[model samples]
Target: LTFDDCNKSDRAFVAGVLRKHGFGATFYVTEGLGFLRNKENYVTWEEIVELDRMGFEIGNHTRTHPHMPGLSPGEMRKELLHIEKRCKEHGIQKPTTFCYPGFGHSLSCVRELQRLNYLFARRGVGPEFKDGGRGGRGPAYDPGVDHPLLVPTTGYAGPDWKMKDLMWAVDQAREGRIAVLCYHGVPAREHPWVNCNPEDFRKHMDYLGEKNCTVISMSDLSLFVDPRKGPEDPYAPIRARMKREK
Candidate 1:
């Protein structure tokens, strides 16, 4: 799920790539940015509506894209709920997923999201397993979190750097783990904060296809894991058998 700070010009570009491969993406929109203001750095609200019409889920990322974890309770509430409202205002009702800006979340962020009835939130960390691999890298992961509201993501940014991240995710999924990729803009524009080239994006998608991993959004993953157990279930047996102190 991607297209952070997207613009109208690249909407079709990103959409075409994914559609060609029989996959779709969910775009989390930042309020009042980009095409909404008709600015030089974003896609239009019309374009977002079009994407929504094209089987893509439009989620919220707060208006003005602030870090809620740092804000006061009142400010955090204002930051997230207001955006959630705007998403509804634009016909994206019942938006269930949210991504904190810069992966920033706090007790306040979680509370506010819960208040707004968000079912899942995406974080930026994964479990640490010493799976056999090259030069000290570890094993992949499976989803189903202790906190269903907080999910993890594997982001792919540069074509070169992305291949490694993709391989890691594929490895984990092959071992029956879940890999949710957190990514940003497409078509390679300014702002390193929101820049990913088209070709680079394709590499990650191609990897998913080749690896045969079911590409899905955060909510889809929740349904994959057994709620009775949690994210820690997969590693439970291993943890007990390995009694040697680290």
Candidate 2:
């Protein structure tokens, strides 16, 4: 599972929960927002470093969260590069993985990311939520078949998510596929739309513990991906069509 946007107030709470469960998470941070000090503020550099000390993956979520598709190529590159630079300055390893701010993406931005040497850039929601249906984020992500830059999540667990939805996602991890759950703020009072109740979050963690599911940080999934294989060439189909036209 991964958490996005550094909510300062919930940092300790979220970290404590993960520690208790012996699980790790990737926290996608935006350092530009690190100045404010309140429930609505991003965590400080010290807190980010502490999370790193606790073994959580500190990933790039840009220097300031922005709509990627709307930014120029230079602007987009700055967003990613600045975060990578900040992580290193803070004694954290350069972030190899990235998450799109607001699920925004563009092919041009992707190209820039490749140039900057990011191993992965995640975007998009996972499965559809249904009532009394086969609840899941659809087919589990097969690194062999999917594009590395556009990893999908099982689903977004918000304030309204129930235990069943969480369990359904975990169950989908079977058959060599992974259920990547996207969580925003754990019980974020300010962002009620994406806020997941603290108790519910605990229940979800408890469920994972009871099921004995292996909860890994996003970076760890790299073990299963073969760098030799690489992501599919985006222009291959276009090139093929042009050749056929000839």
Candidate 3:
């Protein structure tokens, strides 16, 4: 999945490309940075509605995209809950997944998200969440990490970057491990650090398709290990069967 800042033009362009390829993604909305909400540098509410109508999941990023680790617990609550309320007002129900601003969060942030009943609370895919090592410094590719919650994503920085590291992720997906590729832009024209052009994205998507894998929302991934199940699953048989089918 990817997020475009207050770039309405970028939103439409990227969404169009994903739809063209029959792939869906999530756009984590930052309320305060919205186009109509913030006329300076972000996408408009109408653009968000347009993408929502197109079957892309609209998730909560935050009100201002502040670093959660920097906020007090109450402030973090406001950032998480207020944006959630705003999403519902815009007709987005159960906005359960959140992308931490700059991958910043504290345990208090986790409590706040859980209090709000978020199902998928995650940072980027990386070693910190994976093997308990820290994630990437910038958007550099670091293969094979462990944590699902702090899912370390190999930023496909356009087509060239796609050629370099997108395969590592696709390989994991084929092995039944969830591969979450996070990106900053569809065309890495502005932010080369975590940007990727559409052609590269298409090639990457094509690779996933070739693996006979399904592209799913974070919600689908959450169902894999429902906290309520508490490790020893009462539903393991059913899930295992489904996995085998896949």
Off by over 4 Å in 1: 7-10, 32-38, 125-141, 158-160, 225-246
Candidate 1 global lDDT: 0.59
lDDT of 3 by residue, 1-246 (tens): 556353553465777766756776777777653434544445667777777788887778888878788899888888777767877777876577778876665567766776777766556533222312221221222122232334435443433453546665565553445566666556544345555566666676777677765666666565464533222322233244346656
Sliding window of 10 residues with minimal summed lDDT for model 1: 131-140
Q: Ten consecutive residues with minimal summed lDDT in candidate 2?
A: 126-135
Itemize residue pairs with steric clashes in candidate 1.
Answer: 6-43, 7-42, 7-43, 8-43, 142-177, 142-178
Clashes of 1: 6
**TM-score of each candidate?**
0.77, 0.85, 0.74
True lDDT of residue 103, candidate 2? 70
Candidate 2 Cα deviation (angstroms), residue 82? 1.2
Q: Please write out the lDDT profile of model 1 over residues 1-246, one tens digit for every residue.
A: 545545543476777777777775667777644435655567766777777787777777777777666788788777777767766767766567777765566666766776777767665443333322111223333443335445545443433344676677566555455556656656445455445667777887887777665666555555666433444333343243344324
lDDT value, candidate 2, whole model:
0.73
For model 3, the superposed segments whose C-alpha errors exceed 4 Å read 2-10, 32-41, 125-149, 154-160, 188-190, 223-246
